[model samples]
Target: MELKLDTISKHYKDKKAVNQVSTVLKSGVCGLLGANGSGKTTLMRMICGILTPTSGTITPDGQSIYQLGEDYRELLGYLPQDFGYYPDFTAKEFLYYMCAVKGLSLAKTKQKTAELLALVNLEEVANKKIKTFSGGMKQRLGIAQSNINDPSILILDEPTTGLDPKERVRFRNLISDISKDKIVILSTHITSDVEYIADMLVMMKQGEILLTDTPDNAAQSIVGKVWEVEVAAQELRAFEDQYMVANFHHEGERVRLRLIAESQPTENAQPLTPTLEDLYLYHFQEGGTADVSTD
Candidate 1:
């Protein structure tokens, strides 16, 4: 299965949220990485058929999904950033409710809800009221609800918002497990969460896509552009102002900085391997947002 975007655009009164963005998504995970205010959410909404695009069409298998009507939505699973829930309902009841809303039969609802609860590791708390769940557990419940229909096209926005390191890893593994023969578009600012699982990485900036490639290729974009330098703590601010600093650590009285630049910013600066975070900062740094056309 494939989902294709053709010159898709979304505009507010004074700002273009997405501009002529076009890409073909297929079975596997596609990670949408961007800073806040980027058009990731807008683009995802358009694909899910929840928000109509200002221009262009989203198609599946070469036909406008909108024309498919309810058929198109039946195949989609979307977990929005702010998922609403009945605070008093138990996890099992919440999923059963979602199943009913998705038009599942009474028999299938029971089977699927149980399966989804186990899939998200929420079975232990299946009878606990949602109001008592931790943020991570609630996020897990949200994930479970989205899969009520076993959709072929799954869209998740910031799915790891409240998860800790271990939970994040588990969530990534769960996504990978269910991604075979399915299209999963996951949007998040946490690149590390998708670094190992995503088949492709799409970076956005100022409401436009800036880069799209495999993780290795994306990291390669800044191979020789990443550097590390040590400077006095007092010079840290000045150094950061002069370079795109990805990270830094204090060493006794001095600070070691990891930055991205066209050339070494200091004589002693050493070239370092670029990670996904480095790639993210490299594109969104001051004066660095350039549109990377999918064409």
Candidate 2:
């Protein structure tokens, strides 16, 4: 499967939510990384045909998805940041209802509901009411419901937000397994999620794409430009004032700081390789004013 966004743009009166963004995504797992309100959700919504672009077009497998209506939706599965579930319905019933809505035959819905429950590790709770399920379990059920129709493209927005560590790992592996033959777009603020499972990474800032590359490539763009310094606690404020500090922590009387600089700032500071967080910080650390030199 393939998804193409051609010069897509969205405007809200005086503010532009997405600006002439264009990219092609193929069958694999892709990560969308951005800060809150950076337009990642808006982009995903446009691609899913939930929101129309102010200008330009979106196509799935060469078909204009927006104009095609249900034909386009048939090939898509979307789990929004917040999904609703019937409070009184059992997990199995809810999934069954979703399968019906997706146009699956009765026999197919039964088979799919069982398979999805197993895939999401929610089979144990299949007969339990949704009101009794934990936050993580509900999220898993939401994912199961999204895949009822076996869509060729899957879009998950902050899918791991409320998950525990173990649940998060399970969800990550599930996503990776399901992405083998389809396109999966994961949008989240968690950097580690993309670092391990994503085949490609897309970073956005201020309604525009800041970078699109492999995780390693994105980190490499800021390589040799990050630094770590240990200074006396009293001098920490001066260092903060002089640099864009990505993060900092205290060790006894010394303060260890991670700072972004065009070049090494001090002789005592050592150059450090960049991570996804570093890349994220580099983009918005100075109120989006920091000039970044990319490869």
Candidate 3:
């Protein structure tokens, strides 16, 4: 299946939430990397038919999403940025609830609930109340619920936001495993979420689509433009004022800085391999938000 967006735009009274965005997606994991308020959620909302675009076309195959109607919804599995779950419900109850919402019969709901609880490694705690689950376990349940209908297109918004490092890695692996034959769009402000797992990445900044390419290609796009230098701890501030310092680490007495620039900032600035985080910093540092999280 192919999903295509052509010049999609969404406007609030004064703000253009999604500006002239266009792309075609196929079956695979596609990561939407962007900063907060960058319109990633709005674009995904339009794709899920929750919101209408001010201008543009979203089509599955050759038909408009509106034309597809319930047919289109049946193809989707969406987990919004702030996905809601019943705090009183057990893991099993939650999955069964989602199954019923998706219109599954009792027998199918019973079968899918057990299968999904196992798939997300939550069977051991299947009867526990959702309020007691850890962030990772809650997210795992969220994934299980989204899959209740076996959707062809899965949209996850900020899926790994509160997960710890190890849990984040585990979640990414889960997404990677499930995306084998489905079109999965995972939106996140953390570059690490998609850097190694996504098949393709669509970057956004200030409501505009910046670039769409493989993670390697996005990193390679800034080849020879990243530099690292070691300087006194106090001198790091001077470099920050004149160049885009991506990150810094302190050595015994000096600080090692990784920065991005068109030309070498200093004679000692050594070229280093570009990473997805480096590329994110290269485009978003000027936006003045802590830059996209590498952690």
Candidate 4:
């Protein structure tokens, strides 16, 4: 399914959660990346029809979500950043309950429950209470429930937050496998997730989307513009005060500063290729510039 947001805006009292944001998400995996308070959750909620936009509209498959109501919800699946699970309910029971809430017929729900448990590799633990599952297991169970109805559009917010490295890789592969014919919006601040799975990337800051492009294109935006300068530990603070440093690492007695700018800061500085983290930090930081340096 395709999701189109036309000048969608949401407000909480005097603060705007989404400010006239407009974008079209087609079938494939697209990532929404931003720091906390960047309005990603608010935007996802509006798109899922959980929270209505104060202004503008959200359309799924050519129908306005607000006008379509439950019809729109039937085609969507959303996993919020903070999801609640019943402590007393087993994984299987929880999924079955969710399927019921989604209004699926009993036979279909049973079939779907089995399919999802296998998909998430949780068939072995399906009968275990959710309170007994590890963080990663719970996350997998959450994904299973989200896909219970085989939704056409999937919106996942920080889906890999509490997972370990191994679990994260497993989850990434699962998302890639499921994204073939659906519009998947994976929201996270983990740049590596976008690097590995996103066909397109969207960067947001303070309720505004700063950039939307392919991962390669976004990384290319800062090419030849990032510099690595090795400076004395004592001088690091001074260097950071005057430049936009994307990251830094300690090496023995010195620090290697990754700075972003149009021109090199000193003779010792050497140009370095930018990563997604560099591009994201550069665009979202306070007083940061949108200028793309091709050279």
TM-score per candidate, chains pooled: 0.93, 0.93, 0.96, 0.92
Q: What are the per-residue Cα lDDT tens digits for candidate 1 across 1-295?
A: 9889999999998999999898999999999988878999999999998899999989998889878999998789988988999999999999888888878899999999989888989998999999999877888888788877778899999888767777777778888888898899999888786687999988888888888899879998888899999999999999888888777999999999998899988899999998887787777776544222110
How many Å off is the CA of 121 in candidate 1? 1.3
Winner on lDDT (1 vs 4): 1
Error of 3 at 70 (Å): 0.8
- The deviation in Å at residue 174 for candidate 2 is 1.3
| lDDT of candidates 1 onward, in order | 0.86, 0.87, 0.91, 0.86
Summarize candidate 3's per-residue lDDT along 51-108 as a digit string, tens digits. Answer: 9999999998889999988999989999876789999999999888888888899999
What TM-score number comes out for model 2? 0.93
Q: Residue by residue across 119-219, what tens digits does model 2's lDDT show?
A: 98888888999999877788889889888878899999988876777778877888999999989999987787888799999998878888889999999
The best candidate by TM-score is: 3
> In candidate 2, which residue pairs clash?
none
Clashing pairs in 4: none
What number of clashing residue pairs does each candidate have, in the order they appear?
Answer: 0, 0, 0, 0
lDDT of 1: 0.86
Name the best candidate (by lDDT). Answer: 3
Q: For residues 1-295, could you state the per-residue lDDT of candidate 4 as single tens digits?
A: 7788899899989999889999999989999988877899999988887787899988887888868877777788878777899988999999999989888899988999999999999999889999999888888888888887678999999988867788888888999999999999999888888888999998888898888999989899888778999999999989888878877999989999989877888998999988887787677667543322211
Candidate 2 residue spans exceeding 4 A from truth: 287-295
Q: What is the lDDT of candidate 2?
A: 0.87
